[model samples]
Target: MKLREIAHSRTGDKGNISNISLIAYDMNDYEKLKQAVTAEKVKAYFSDIVKGDVVRYELPNIGALNFVMYSALGGGVTRTLAHDMHGKGLSAALMNMDI
Candidate 1:
């Protein structure tokens, strides 16, 4: 099962840092996401692009997981020559993860 089936993601970027928020559509699926999704997994999944550490913050009250990835934007939007400088596609890529 793909993560997208149960949740959706939103991404934000600042400097070389990228933050992805995974929010479950149904509250019941939150636990399942928590069990399967981890900072390590996310870090590994985006290893090619992310150059630093991945940190996950659980927001049980909102049934969401927030991942902070460092050194992920090449060198931030202002400096990176990549087409998707904002790293928004990363959220969609993360949705492809198996749950």
Candidate 2:
């Protein structure tokens, strides 16, 4: 199953970094998410776009996982010629990950 089936995501950006938060639809699935989604996996998944380190922060109390992707915004929104400068579509792209 895709991650989207069990969780939803929100995206934010600052300079060349992208912050993606994945929240489980049900608290019971939080464990599954933690086990399946890792910083290494996310870095590999977005290898084409993410040029720096990927860090994962667990939010067990909120049933969510936050990923901080460095050098992901093509040198920030103002300078990037990329269509999705704000990296909004990144959340949607992440949702497609297989769980």
Which predicted model would earn the best lDDT?
2
Name the weakest run of 10 consecutive residues (lDDT summed) in model 2: 82-91
TM-score of each: 0.95, 0.96
The residue pairs that clash in candidate 1, if any, are none
* Structural RMSD, model 1: 0.9
Q: After superposition, how far is residue 83 of candidate 1 from its true place, in Å?
A: 2.2
- CA lDDT, candidate 1, residue 11: 92
List lDDT for all candidates, in order: 0.93, 0.93
TM-score of 1: 0.95
lDDT of 1 by residue, 18-82 (tens): 99999999999999999999999999999999999999999999899999999999899799888
